[model samples]
Target: MNTRQSRLDVLHSLRERETRSGYGWALSTDVPPGLQQSLQTAAAQGLVELADREIRAELSAHEGRPVLWAARLSPQGHDVLTYLDASPDPTPNCTPPSADEQVIELRPAQMDALRVYANLGPVLRVAPADGLVERVRTAYFDRPGNRWRMTLTTEQIDSVAYAFYLRALSGSVAEANWFARKYGVTYRVDPATGRPGAVRPRARTVSP
Candidate 1:
């Protein structure tokens, strides 16, 4: 059996015995060393606690050695088992954004706003303007030859919108909208449900 299955069996065994605050497993003399090692790992991951054997029968007959031989689920381990036993929800239907869907040209301040917002999610805060500019420069614009690319690509815009979406979803809409309006951008509203959708840049006015 795979290591995962073996570990799972160990956990189930503990459950079957309703192992509480005492020496848990008294393995047979034939149990493999690999499964014993697996138990050690499970203990390390906060899944189970292994205790030294309390009885002579719990010691390995062949090795004539005391076994580190008891198991009980930790609080985290119990939570994992509970989640695994629960009914799972169906997968949601979702479509990825197209390559050039609603591309927006960013002004300098708008770009900084996006950079700061993306750096911290749902925090309702921004770094200093200069600091944000330095970060954006270091991350995307700065080149090996000390050159910089001023224009933002569709991919960059998509990333900004996605980050904004996460922030808005986390209940920071008011703060997000304030920044959006300040930067001449708006969080897209879903026409069907009239909820905030994606972040989009405003069209530049052509002054005659």
Candidate 2:
């Protein structure tokens, strides 16, 4: 069977015997001997963890173990369960872009603001102007490069807005305005009386 089928089979077995046994399956049997291998695969994939490795058998723990048995969630296991539980649904209508989408280049000042907001580590060295934005854009799009790029989500933006008034603060208004314009988001402020005008760019359409 394929990996998906094997995983489903293993999960099914675990779900079935969850309440009846000594911390799930003790060992695999003729009824389904490949369960051990499936568990190992799940452990490798982060869905489970090797809770214990005794001379007799290896034990695996799932998410419920933490809540039901007061077990601790290992960092790796926690990341895996979070991914599995919160993964976005895939739909036929959603498709990845075939070619690079046109991206607005970040100005030097804007790049500095992004770095500050995103808490990027010390700038190693600035790239030349000609290829800087393209490189930055690629880093922004790549999940593994999240450390360097401004990966602010909508919710995070809202939180930041509540925490501080960027426009009212010294030396921050321009950068704040630039970011607000780029994302087409407006901070909560009096439209008629605010120092920084509430005007923002039209929201850009994005593809999945």
Candidate 3:
């Protein structure tokens, strides 16, 4: 299972336990010993939060070092886990839509449409052609309005296009849009409003 899934299982296990439960032993017993380390890492990453201060103290006492055990999910972590749980798997092993299918080259207008769709959520997949696999990527929701955004260098355009082609092969239009919005390097004008369209990074521009 993926890291998020493993962390989710750990969180569920923790939630099932009674309050005041010990941390170290509970973690070793509940999750695989190998995964215990991952759990700790997850905690450090703020993906999971411990319930009580006493548990941290106990862990520290046992380890004879200062230990921090607040595994509560941060808002971003929660969003990631929630998205992972909800999104359909878009790996390459999944069957493609069809053989002998033509690759869809995204137009500037289509790319803009994709950006509008992707700003709504964090997880998106895109497929653009046959003989290619789905490309899956995560987006960070920007502050304030929570706009989904991703940065890619111009050289990465082919990689991004491959991803979009894969999503298109999977017949996931929404996922395709997300991939386009996150990676498309072209722009288009809105015919109705006559406003500046989604910003497309130039191939010569390098993301810092």
TM-score to true structure, per model = 0.30, 0.33, 0.32
Candidate 2 colliding pairs: none
Angstrom error of the Cα, residue 70, model 1: value is 2.6
Please give the distance, in angstroms, between residue 122's alpha carbon in candidate 2 and its true position after superposition: 31
Q: Is candidate 1 or candidate 3 better by lDDT?
A: 1
Evaluated against the true structure, the overall lDDT of model 2 is 0.42
* The best candidate in terms of lDDT: 1
lDDT of 1 at 68: 41
lDDT of 3 by residue, 1-208 (tens): 9966677776555444313344423433344555556557767877655547786687668767765433444455567657766663433232342442222334443444444434422454532222122221333333454343333334234444444444455565664465456545323344555763333555697789
Question: Which residue pairs of candidate 1 clash?
Answer: none
Which portions of model 2 miss their true places by more than 4 Å?
A: 1-16, 19-23, 26-31, 40-79, 90-179, 188-191, 194-208
Query: How would you order the candidates by lDDT, starting with the best?
Result: 1, 3, 2
1-208: candidate 2 lDDT, tens digit per residue: 9977566555555545443444543333322445656666766766554444441232323323222111122356455445655543322112332343223334555555543434422342421223333333334322343233322334444433322234236446765555556655555555666654334345689999
lDDT of 3 at 73: 49
